[model samples]
Target: MSRRVVRQSKFRHVFGQAAKADQTYEDIRVSKVTWDSSFCAVNPKFLAIIVEAGGGGAFIVLPLIKTGRVDKNYPLVTGHTAPVLDIDWCPHNDNVIASASDDTTVMVWQIPDYTPVRNITEPVITLEGHSKRVGILSWHPTARNVLLSAGGDNVIIIWNVGTGEVLLSLDEMHPDVIHSVCWNSNGSLLATTCKDKTLRIIDPRKSQVVAERARPHEGARPLRAVFTADGKLLSTGFSRMILLRRLKELALASPPGDAESLGVVCCDCMPTAQGNNFEEPVALQEMDTSNGVLLPFYDPDSSIVYLCGKGDSSIRYFEITDEPPFVHYLNTFSSKEPQRGMGFMPKRGLDVSKCEIARFYKLHERKCEPIVMTVPRKSDLFQDDLYPDTPGPEPALEADEWIAGQDAEPVLISLKDGYVPPKHRELRVTKRNILDVRPPSSGPRRSQSASDAPLSQQHTLETLLEEMKALRERVQAQEERITALENMLCELVDGTD
Candidate 1:
């Protein structure tokens, strides 16, 4: 007879508490886009959410400190001609953010430290390479100004935002639409899941698939994948089981169960050192039968993985360990309303004094609420175990260095003294001027060069000119309206006199 041993984890007793009514952001009209995006993005300084705009795409950015009812006419970050699908904050710069829209373009904006009095209608630079709606955006984990965008065209374009140029375009990797894309700890490799029912580990610099597994899940539903702290792949899909694959071997390891189960399955890849071959996935856990897609957010500092379903009312988190039960269920944060989308705060953004292990901005139909997960502590001093040295705002590598095959871990910062967000840093784009290029000194070549500008470049220039003209006209109309209102007020004052 053997006794069953129970696993112990500090996060086992962690409980989630919603912020006070005054602390939560409210009265915001969340976007109604049915796209499979989080629709919200956050950093230590600001909270951004895709919102409903009349004629075009727009998202609202709010100062994290200034929480309460948002004014109906609050300024927005608007420039996309179509509905914005996804938004991601740059890990290295708190003031910088990237947005993807259905207009087949990506725009990066630099938000100011103080709230703006008017809408930020212009982007620092516009990247127009995707031929279809761009739905997913992810910034390089360790590189500054290196952003990745996946579009409906089934192409992934990694851009150097600082120079307004495409660094790498992985156009031929996935045969179908890419459902999800994640960077490893060092940003050297990418873990992506595509609609083709396959999971791939791609080395974007080499433009090659290092390892891949076909049909990790048999269901046709969307799949999501993220790299763990140990560099293993953890993927979840509608096939009612999560499949974990070892990157070295591309073998699947999942919990023992019927792969035909009718629910979302969560699996963690077991690390292995062996030959490259496909192995059956072993499932670690079976989730609820809800149709909502589970979005897994991994915290490398804490070794904790939070699973947030799109339309679910609760957030379930797990602790990944090296023991038998590789993934341990911690607890679920339940609420009354299902979250339409969620914004996860970086570990550095959490309040270390409050013993906050994780923080989430849960999006509702008409409001955005803050949910804090804390581990109770007996002492008031800083808990070293709970708060480890986490990735800070400073980047470890530049865009060019990363593109040139250099990899470095994120620079870590201690939370002992708490973290202070740096002052606003503007992202500058150094676009190449077409006129700067000198044509061949030879006669025939010089004449040909005058009319040989790339069609795409010409189209982009024309688009920018049209947008500037429209904006000028809009400003002029507003000025006239203001003058008319001032005259009317003056007349009323004279009549009263």
Candidate 2:
């Protein structure tokens, strides 16, 4: 018998550490619709993934420079008492991360610098209002300290993390649970998808639904949506499979403009897949038999929308233009290992000089691998073939510069020298001792005698007992685990008869 070889992707350099190492996340487990974003968006520098950690919630933040099991220096954000369903990296500050859990609370955490054991046991601030599990969180794209969270209570709460206050709460906005929320480029408007099978665009200033699109899909499947760079809404849901329940095509439901332009077109398989049985006819690497959800990440700087599917091993890219049909199919990158989750690095975080345009981190049963998407240039020289007349990223407003009652023009990255390659970070694994994260405290410092700070400086009995208790519990757990493994081995040996 012969095995078929997986074809190499011409446009992508998929890289990761070998799975033989103890790199797979030991605490995470496979989950469902989760509504939790697989990747947190502090792109280009850091990526965070939420996992089912024991009876509570925890997230692992990965540095873009390393792959395989995360290094000891990376911060593992934890503290919730239930599974973390969603996480969002603060757009205004890279060090800040916000997480939501089934525990009905949202926490804001600040990541510490490279230290072997930087565990976040307490959050800087906690927002508690929802009576149900908080499954969604989205950071304000243009403003600082602003966050949006939705829960099963069918409410949208805007939190000001700087003051630990709830700026606005549409306590009874939707009739059903909110599935997703998205901010427009300028941050003046927000769009939400709900279990009631509707998409509503809300003007936060007025706290009213300025426009809405009902029944986006013909069938009743869970829906996810995001705003395009030009302010149009793109949503994903399942198709009308009366029998098997197939996935739906990426749909651009509303017109590409302000709330006033939405009354024209209601969504479906969009222009590319229109009149073609409503199935997304992409060049997919794998045909998934199970129903999957398409999570989209859009890059305003490049005008590319990357669609990552749940329970599948492929990523499909499409281009959005100003012309009719708006969406253009690019290509699909596929692999043999199925991804339980995935994250994308932003353009500013990419190594543009090396002809690199995009990067994706894929999580498997045991490991997280990076897939680098490029435009395929021959040499490191400036080639227009790989460099389309691409526009730089346009910030609706600067981090510290947002004016009330004003919308600013978009900003751009330097088109001439924006993507010079050598400085871009290449993802690779660095081999070091597991204990290499910290240096011995041997720097210039005054030494103190044991009697100088007797009771205050020394470890107290209470502290020692607490540490011993923790160690004892850990040893007991390990012993039980070893016994279970031995019994399993014996069962396998006896079965050989």
Please report the candidate that would top TM-score against the real structure: 1
- Candidate 1: tens digits of C-alpha lDDT, residues 115-172: 7767889788999999999999999999989999999999999999888889999999
CA RMSD of each candidate after superposition? 6.8, 14.1
Local distance difference test, each candidate:
0.83, 0.64
Q: TM-score of each candidate?
A: 0.84, 0.69
**Deviating ranges (above 4 Å) for candidate 1:** 1-3, 240-278, 443-497
Model 2 segments more than 4 A misplaced: 1-36, 39-42, 70-75, 116-118, 243-245, 256-290, 379-406, 409-497
Candidate 2 lDDT at 319 equals: 74
Worst 10 residues of 2 by lDDT: 276-285
Residue 417 accuracy (lDDT) in model 1? 88
